[model samples]
Target: MKFPSLFSPLKVGPYQLQHRVVMAPLTRMRAEKPSLAPRPLNVEYYAQRATPGGLIIAEASPVVNTGFGSPGIPGIYSEQQIAGWRKVVDAVHAKGGIIFLQLWHVGRVSHSSFQPGGALPVAPSAVAISSEFKAMTAEGKVVEYETPRALETSEIPGVIDAYREGAKNALKAGFDGVEIHGANGYLIEQFLQSRSNLRTDQYGGSIENRVRFLMDVTKAVIEVWGANRVGVRLSPYGIANGSGEADPMPLYSHAIKSLDPLGLAYLHFIEPRSSGAGRAEVNHQNVPSAMVLYRPMWSGVLITAGGFTGETADAAIAAGHADAIAFGRIFISNPDLPRRLRRAYPITPYNRATFYGGEQKGYTDYPAHDEMAQA
Candidate 1:
């Protein structure tokens, strides 16, 4: 009753959501080591955040062995991995929550150390990320990104197959749906941006050509999960992971318009002034709002995430800029996020140091607000 619109019911595809505070797909590098699977610890974390009828887009999971860029992040390619994710999906569903796995391939955002045979990371082109950004080695050391090997036209289909395989694995894992990781300078985005994509094939050059790979990947996932159970995340005006289009409007305009007729469950966007770290909330001037700019172009349900508080979230929905708001930084430290926000409870500040690669200390130790009062 507090934030009426934020707490209001909404229909997403076939599922009816109880609230609009969707959990953003966060990359917390804490999967079971060595095997790179979701262990009991990972299951407990997701279960703690599950709310009846609420949606949680689980962390970005590499689809294949070569898709990995960071250590300890879970993979969905192996039998062990599928069994592990099954536990996670079951736990969330037990609490009546809907979960989606984000299929990902890091592309040139990776280093050779993480590659199978010490091969250079693959991308649409062989261009390296500028010195401003660095890649993390499998050993945990950070190094400059190398110029990735361009995929031979024939090899491109194999990469798309990896995403299709991941989609099938998500269904086997018992997930309600799956989201394609087409944003952030990953493989799909490597093919979307002109500077990073310099091929003369059907997947490069014009905007339509640049968008081909995304459509291919989307259609592939739809074949596995169907259009209503699938979603796509894009960053039209973003510069994350050293990816930026000099002119994002024309490229993203075509991409959104192209996807409009697919009838996906929803389209998610990362605001230009935001990232999982939450630092982009400050000192970011002249950054365009992703929802405000593209909401008109998209016809289906639209979800956007950035620096949003309870009041701002409701305002966005009330103003029709976005149908739902995804929270990242604040959600990490607050398990009962929807309830606390609905009641206007004090928010727990997150420790940036422990945001990634930690154990129970910063992972599942955040007590619910009721526990704080009972203490």
Candidate 2:
């Protein structure tokens, strides 16, 4: 078969996948109102892309009310939200696809308008992000991010508890597993990187201290879903959401060594060039591939994302760099992406304008390859 490595079956934790193509977590923001529940539209959207034997990591969902980074972003902290996710899980399962929910907390990337009682967002340190960030308010208005408050050391346990509870809720929602959103300048990334986390307490300073929060949350979630079913995502060169480290190799290398013994499902890494958020002004040509830096330290399954096409993805797996590849935009436009890639068919480009906060037009209206041919 063409792209033999890409089309080969691989084992991830307890489950065996038919192919190595994974649906990356892409935020479309089509969830239902005030409750931030996954709506019927979400079910149809995911179901359409739920190619049997492929794995799908659903979009990022806040673990608590204060963790919200945008309007219409789904949450797993409520009973209604759990029910909403159950529908999504059931839809994907019906199509014989395995799905995982991405647990997230935006941390300092949020605004006071998205917080309760107009409270400022919280982070490991009081240091305000120096980059530009826009968030949708509760009233449907978009505004710039406000300076965030430094989280008290005593309050740190509460954040870990939120992740534990979210994992439990994901189980109740019938998800096969949960992926900790530790990348893209979110809460976990905020704590891992030096620029965003300036705390002198046990949660910051040295690389060991900086990674404490990530370890705590991972342990907590692993308690709910075993380490074999848990995965962590990291963006070593990510400058998105205004979080970047002056020297990240040592920090992430240390972090991976620490997590290696956990026997986790997989370590997901976003490639440097493919970070869709913000860019660091410094030249990134010297930054090495995450696989090259992390493969020796981590022996478990590795999933690499960011700007990989069919040919490149196959090349990555063939070169023994990664076990699987996650496609974000490609899966968005091509619901039957595996079949398209296997057959070497042309793909339909997605409409960037209607990507977020939209109806069925850009969300579920994209026709499958066969449907397009019949049209």
Candidate 3:
């Protein structure tokens, strides 16, 4: 039997993973709302994809009500939500899979309908995103993005507190670790980019100020999960969710340098092409691939995500550029992706239409290769 590099076991933080293929955080929006809790449907969905001794970073979950941006999005601040996720954690653990919760807070990519008491969403600055965004309301109605209010200086610590509390809740919910969602134009990314962050305070001007919020949040989360079990996701040139920078390399290089000393679990980078067309075009002129840019800067475990095939992922691991390869869409269609890749099995095509806001049709209906072979 020929062993692929991707099938090799590696240590990520405190856990020793069986393989280097990680299930990236994906939002399916299947959780029940009002409480925004995970249901049996979610339990079934994650359990189906659980690979023994592999790592799975669960979907992005809101940390606060004001940070809610979509319908059926789970939260970690509520007891009911904690109880709901316990089922998921237990289910994954039962299958011998390690799962981490991705903590999220959408800033300007939100509508008032999803906010608390219809208050405007808060961001690093009052700058409204020029790009259009769709947000699901509390009533399940989709609405356009609204102009967000700038977060007051006095309110910054409270925002950090929310992340701390969310991390604590994740621990109570039985998650092995936590991944802070700092990528893709969310609250932390909003602060990182100059186009969206127009504030003149200590949290705004230089790249140091831009990275302050993320650093603060990481520290707070580390207080709960510690540096070993904590991870961070970053999209340096990402223009999604209405945020971008004139030059992302410098900002990201500095950001990576700042984060390198923390001794965190892993630093996950969403490749430029994965961020969307707008960001790709902007970065095409000067930026190199994420691995090329960050490989030397970071010494710890590094994971890269985008469009990757089994061959490409194996080559990446063999080349020593990435410690692990995270798959999003591929994992959606192929539940036993690691086994499939190891044997070079045929992959099932996924339906993009049923990707979100659906029941078990596209969520949990995808069968494993063994099951398909049996049929």
Q: Pick the candidate with the highest lDDT.
A: 1
lDDT (Cα, tens digit) per residue for candidate 2, span 1-375:
344499999888998899999999988888999789999999999999887788999999999999987778999999999999999999999999999999999998888888899999998877776636565576668676667899999999999999999999999999999999999999999999988888999999999999999999999999999999999999888777777889998999989999889999999998876665322223245557887678888989999987778898999998889999998887888888988988889988877777778789888998999999999
> Which runs in model 3 stand beyond 4 Å of their true positions?
1-4, 132-136, 139-143, 277-287
What TM-score quantifies how close candidate 1 is to the native fold? 0.97
Clashing pairs in 3: none
| Candidate 2 residue runs with Cα over 4 Å from true position | 1-4, 140-142, 277-287
Distance from true location, Cα of 212 in model 3, Å: 0.5
**Candidate 2 minimal-lDDT segment of 10 residues:** 276-285
Flag regions of model 1 displaced more than 4 Å. 1-4, 275-283
lDDT of 1 by residue, 1-375 (tens): 354488889888889999999999988899988899999999999999999999999999999898888888999999999999999999999999999999999999899999989999999999999998888999989888899999999998898899999999999999999999988888999999998999999999999999999999999999999899999999877788888999999999999999999999999998887742432334355889999999999999999988899999999998899999999888999999999999999999987777779799778999999999999
* lDDT values, one for every candidate: 0.91, 0.88, 0.87
| Residue 143 CA displacement from its true place in model 2, Å | 3.3
TM-score of each model, paired residue for residue: 0.97, 0.96, 0.95
The local distance difference test score of model 2 is 0.88
Clashing pairs in 2: none
- In the range 79-192, model 3's lDDT, one tens digit per residue, is 999999999999999999999999999998777887768889999988777646565566768666677899999999999999999999999999999999999889999999
